[model samples]
Target chain A: MSEALVDALNPALFWEYRQVLLRGLAFNAYVFFSAATVALIVGLAAALLRVNRAWPFRWIGTLHVEVFRNAPDYIMVIWVHFVLPLLLGKLIGQRVEFSPFASAVIALGFVYSGYFAETFRAGIQSIPQGHLDAGRACGMAESTILWRIILPQVVRRMLPEAVNQFVSLFKATTIVSLIAVPDLMYQVSMVTQQEMRPLPLYTGAAVTYFAVIYVVAGSVRGLSERWRNKIYA
Target chain B: MDAIPAIRVVDLRKNFGALEVLRGVSFDVHRGSVVSMIGASGSGKSTLLRCINRLETPSAGEVFIDGEPMGGPVTANGERKERPLSDINRMRRDLGMVFQQFNLWPHMTVIGNVIEAPLRVRRMKRKAAIALAEECLARVHLSEKGTEYPARLSGGQMQRVAIARALAMQPKAMLFDEPTSSLDPELTDEVLTVMRELAADGTTMIVVTHEMAFARDASDRVLFLHNGQIEEEGPPDQVFGAPKSERCRQFLSKKLQ
Candidate 1:
C-alpha cells in the first residue's frame, strides 16, 4: 500500500493535477454563490414565519423547515438531478429552465436554509422586546425598525452560523459530481481515470478541499472578530 | 396661566381587554413645568405616560398635545377612531419619550442612536446631526463616549444615552416612564442628575418615577395615581410632605415595606 501510494506521487502528477483543481474552484464558486442566495432567502423567510403566530403561514414555514432540515443534502441533490424537472414541470404544465448547476444549489440551499432559518429565528427573537419598543417609540415606520434596528442585529448575530452553513454548502457541492456538473470531486475523478492512481488523486482533491475550507475558516474568523469589535465596542 | 397647556387629557379611558387601566383620567400640563407621576405598581402611572405619547391608544376620550389632538378620537358612544399614519408620526416626533428599559439600539453606537431621528425625521445633514448628537451627549455627560455601544456601557450610562437620544430630536415635550427604575441605586443618581439638569433648562419633562426623592426635589407638581386615576395632585411639598388622600398615605407607607 505504501509503495502504491509513493509510486502515484510523481512531480509530473502534481503539476498536471493543479489545473483540474483550479477548474474545480471556478465551478464550485457558482454553486457557492447560488446556494448562498437561496439560503439567505429561505432563512430570512423562515425567520419571519417563526414570528408569525397565524396557523397557516407558520405551518407552511414549519413544513418547509422540518422536511428540509431532516433530509440529507445528497439525497435532495439526486432528486433534483433526476425527478424534479419532469414531474414538477408536468404538474405545473409549463417549460422550466433548470440547469444542473442551478438545481445543485437549490437542493443544497433548501437543505441548509432550514438550518440557517432556525439560527436566524433564534437570533431575531433573542433580541429583547426593548429594542422593538425603542424603534416604535421613536415613531419609525415598521420597516425602519426591521431594517435599521432589528435586521442588522439579526445579521450580526447570525453571521458565524451563516458562514458555517456556507462551508457546508461548499462541501456538499462536491456531491453534484455524481450529477455531471464537473465540480471539484468530478475533476478529481477525471484525473484519476487518466493517471490510474486513486491514491495521489485522492490526496490532491483532499488538499484542494482542505485549502478552500482553510481559507474560508480564516475569512470567517476575521469577519467574526471585526463584527464582534464593532457591535461590542 | 394664559400659556397653552402642553398636554391636556380629558376623560381619558384605556383598557387592555376587560381590565380598564385609565379610568376617566383628566389632567393638564402647562407649557414649561416638570410634572412627575408617582404611584405603586399597576396603578397606571406608566400607562398614563404611554398614553400621553400614544404608545397605547386610549379606549375612550382625548389627549391634546400642544393644542393638537393625539390618541385620536372616540365617539360620544366610545368607538375608537383611527388617525392616518403620517399624522401619527408627526405627532410622535413632537413628543419624545424615554423608557424604563432604556431601549437603546444595541446595533448602533451611542452617536448612531442619538442621530437616527434627526436624520430620518428632521432630514438634517449627517454632519449637522452628528454635531447635534455630540451636543446632546454632552448634556447627558456622555460626550466622550460617542463611539461607545450600549452593551458596553453601565446601565446608568445607557439610560443617559437614551435621554440624549430623546433630547436630540428637539421635541416640545418629553416623557419618561420610570426611567431610572431599571437602574441600581448608584446608577439612579446618574440618571436623576441628567433629569435635574434638564429640569433646570426648562425642558418640560413629564417623568414617571419611583424615586420619591426625585419626585420631591425635581417636580413642580406631583400626581399620586391610585387605581388608574389621580388620587391627589398638588405641589410636591403639599402632596408628598402633607398627604390629603387616604390612598396617598397608604402608598407612601407601603414604600417603607
Candidate 2:
C-alpha cells in the first residue's frame, strides 16, 4: 500500500496502454468467438462419426482427434504460423496473403475442434439407444433427431466441459502472438521490453487472463443453474 | 371385429454371430385386444416384440404390420437392399414401445419428456404439445407432477411417465417390454392400472411380461414362448390353466405359483 511501491509499479501506465488493451481484447474475443463457432460444428460432426458402428468414417474422425489431441497444441499453432503462410503465399502469391489472424483462426478452430469433438462424442454416446428409438418412433428424421433431440441433450449435459474448452481456447490465443497478431500477451511483452519490468508485465497478463476466464466460466455456471431449475422443477 | 390381423410376425429368425435367438417364430396379434407373451428368460418374447418394430432385425423371415410385410430385404435393381433408417423411422410412428428400464430422458421434466416427441418429431405447436402432454399425463394420473423431471420421480412415476409419453404419440398399437418386471409389487399395480385403463379405451397392446397373474386376468390371448418359439398360444384360460406343451405347463406352474 506504500506510495513508492505503487509509483514504482506505475499502475498509471495502464491508462497510456488503453488503446493497446482495447485492441488486445478485440483480438482475443475475435479468435475465441470465430474459432469456437467453427469448433462447435466440427465437434458435433466428429462426435456423430465416433458414435455409429460404421468403420471408415469412425476411423477418420477418431484418427483426426487423437493425432491432434495427443500432440502439443503449441506445435499446431507454430505450424500454422510458420508453414501455412509460405504454402499459402506460394499458391496465391501476394494476391491472397495469409495473416497471423487468419492463421490463428484456422489453427485454433481446427485443433481445438478435435478435442471438443471427442468431448461431444462422449456426450452424445452417453445418451441411450432407447432415447434415440423414442425419437424415431415419434417419426423424427435423422437430421431432426441430431439437431433438436440429440444436440440439445448434448449441449445441456456437456455445458461445463464446453465452457471449459472455451476458456482453454481463449488462453490458446496467446500462442498466436508468436506469428505476430499482437494479442494480450504481445502487448504485455511490449510493456516488458519498454520498461524492463518482466515480473509486473507478466503479472498483469496473468491477472487479465484469469479475469477473462473467470467471467466466462461464471456466466456458464449461472446459465447452467437457471436452466437446471427450469428443467428439474 | 376380427378382421385382418393388426400385426402378423411370420417365421422370424434371428442369429447373432452363429447363436440363434429366435428360431422360426410366427404369430398373429388381433386388433383391439391385449396379447400377452410370457416365457422364461432367453425365450425370445422380447426379441419378437422388437422385431415387430424392426428394432431387432430378423436374420431370416419377415414381420408384417397390417398385412404389409416388413423386416425383409427389398428388391432394388435386381439386388436385395437392406431397408434404410429413414424408411424404418417412418414405419415406426404407428407403433410405440416402452422398455423394462422405463428409458425416460433423465434431463427432461415429466411433461417435457412427454411432449418432446410430438413437438420435435411431429413438429406440433408448443401450446398444442403441452395440452396433449397434459391429456396423456392426466390419463396416467400424474397431471400435477408434469413439471418434475424423471430423476426426481419414483420408479413407478417414471414408468407412468414413459407410458404417458408413448400415449402422447397416439400410436396405433403399443408394445410393452417387461413393463412390470422392474417395479416393486405396489409400483407394478400402479402401472397395471394405467395399462388396464388403456385396454378399456380399446388401444391394442402386445405385452411381454413375467406377471402370470396379470397375464391371466388382463390378456385376451396368451403366448407362451419356449426356446425362442411359441410353444403354446391360446386364450388365457387355456394357456394359463391348461397349457398344451410341457414347456408351457412347466413354466406356468413355476411362474404362477
Question: Which whole-number lDDT from 0 to 100 does residue B4 have in model 2?
Answer: 67
* All models, RMSD in angstroms: 2.6, 2.6
Q: List chain A TM-scores, every candidate, in order.
A: 0.92, 0.88
* Tens digit of per-residue lDDT, candidate 1, span B16-46: 9999898988988887789999998999998
TM-scores for all candidates? Answer: 0.92, 0.92
For model 1, the DockQ equals: 0.51
Here, model 2's chain A TM-score works out at: 0.88
Docking class of 2: medium
Among these predictions, the greatest lDDT belongs to 1
Off by over 4 Å in 2: A1-6, A88-96, A191-199, A225-233, B72-81
Which candidate wins on DockQ?
A: 1
